[model samples]
Target: MFTDEEFEKYLKELDNPDLSEFEFFTESTGVKVYRRYNKTSGLYDYKTIGGIDVPVDTCFAVYTDLEYRKKWDSYVKELYQFEEDGKKGVYWRVAFPFPLSNRDYVFVRETREFDLNGKHIYVCLGRSAEFKSKKEKSGVVRVNDFLQSMIFTSDGNGTKAFMHYYDNPRGMIPTWLINWAAKSGIPGFLAKMVIACNSYDKYLASKK
Candidate 1:
């Protein structure tokens, strides 16, 4: 279990990651994703940092709204709150392309909001969790090794976002595919998110 203070400390570290160790993977629009190998874990870790042309609140809402996720996140086949408390849940049947088994995650997610340097910052932390209600679904592989965190800071007329993600989907996946997904897939997802945010903002404006 990670405390809020610990999460905060980790988030700060991600902000100033040792760029010397991380190699550039890909960039889409303004988002840049990087990849590095962790010798200790024998797994690849990814970091992404970029600015989106949307308010911090809007960007944060787009990320946390479960119901709205399916509209923008193409890979999310199903998502629902399994536990009553809503903090612990399952991401069911995330779609991977042909020849790769679908994957799912059971995670505990927490969010914190604070102000730093006169800017509002929101941090979301998620880690894999074992829950009694979670069970492997047919044709979908359960992802047990997953840790993800996202930080969004209010920038002038937009939001600056940072993400650190690590996951090991145990299967017979090619190293080239894994590298491609980390490089191309993530930035594409973020680009779609920016479009979603803009559309949502227009929807909100129309209601006014």
Candidate 2:
């Protein structure tokens, strides 16, 4: 869950962000990424804009299906939901290349729908939170300072996606790793997501 102020601020940013404030990072396979410096975290905040050749509803379904994601996204080492002290959140562990420790996150995510100028928009937001049931593992970097907001809307026969991403992966990050994330990691994830969305229905059917 998010605070009212945070909700309002994120909505404004997603609805209308000043491009002048961000520097172009990279574009891959039709997906464009921009980044801006964050003084507080001493890290960069990224914006991903792209068009997916899938319906908005399908995109939402695929994005929210945590279990289904594990089947397609090979980068996810571990992912699941947990509830403790009457509060619930998700736990995620991501794989990293050799010489770098894996990264983990504990966060709560929410989805909302809105109508702006007669257009439907779906937003999925996530923020880092602590859970008594979850603890950091040894040799794994915990990403406690993280925020993600993704917007999805119909674009003709396809869907348009806008995502704002920020996270402190903890420890030292090499310049090459950052560049790889921008040029390949982000865009590659999106590309795989489209394939997942297209096959989500079949994935669900197999479960039944």
Candidate 3:
């Protein structure tokens, strides 16, 4: 735990961050996340799935539970037919009931969840939000259009997460606005992932 002095020092650093401090390093997973404010257009982020310690495999697997999702994850409702690795599935939009609520839970129609042929993204049981995988996507990552791509890499140690949001808004939004949204939203989303690991730990300990 950080002491009061240590916490103050940390806050001071955050206030006037060193650019070098923001630079990405080689994580055990070998995933490179370039964390930065979108100076040009969009935002990029690098963060652990959960703020606390989480083994990667433990993190990814828990991301698939269709029910009991609300216990850890914030802004997603019930999931339907959401495949783990195939390509596509369904999850509802949801809203959290508090300030700084990480997940933006809002239930949407199944049809709304997908495209003309159910060709899109929806939700993840745990890992990260859904999106056009550039390969596959569903609920959270799958916006009405291309929004952000949240990717994960797992090595023996743990997982490294990355996010890249399109710079410009589709309908009427501008690039900076969209980037701001990405910056504002991504951190909390990443931090909330701890719920998954913690919940699993509780489950395992209970079984023992």
Number of the top TM-score candidate: 2
Candidates' C-alpha lDDT: 0.79, 0.84, 0.40
Task: Select the stronger candidate by TM-score from 2 and 3.
Answer: 2
Give the clashing residue pairs of candidate 2, or none: none
TM-score of each: 0.88, 0.90, 0.42
- Compared to the true structure, candidate 2 yields what TM-score? 0.90
Highest lDDT model number:
2
Runs of candidate 2 exceeding 4 Å displacement: 12-15, 39-42
Any residue pairs clashing in model 1, and if so which? Answer: none
Off-target runs (Cα >4 Å) in candidate 1 are 11-15, 18-20, 40-42, 84-87, 202-208
Better of 1 and 2 by TM-score: 2
Model 2 lDDT tens row, 1-208: 6666765665666547657789999998777899988776666888988889999899988998899989999989999988888777999999988889999999998888888776788888898998877889999999998888888888878888888888888788854567556667788889899999989989989989
Q: Rank the candidates by lDDT, best first.
A: 2, 1, 3
lDDT of 3 by residue, 75-133 (tens): 56544544545545444445433332222211211111112232222222122345342
TM-score of 3: 0.42
lDDT by residue (tens digit), candidate 1, 121-144: 888888888887677878889989
> In model 2, what lDDT does residue 104 have?
96
Minimal lDDT window, size 10, model 1: 84-93
Worst 10 residues of 2 by lDDT: 6-15
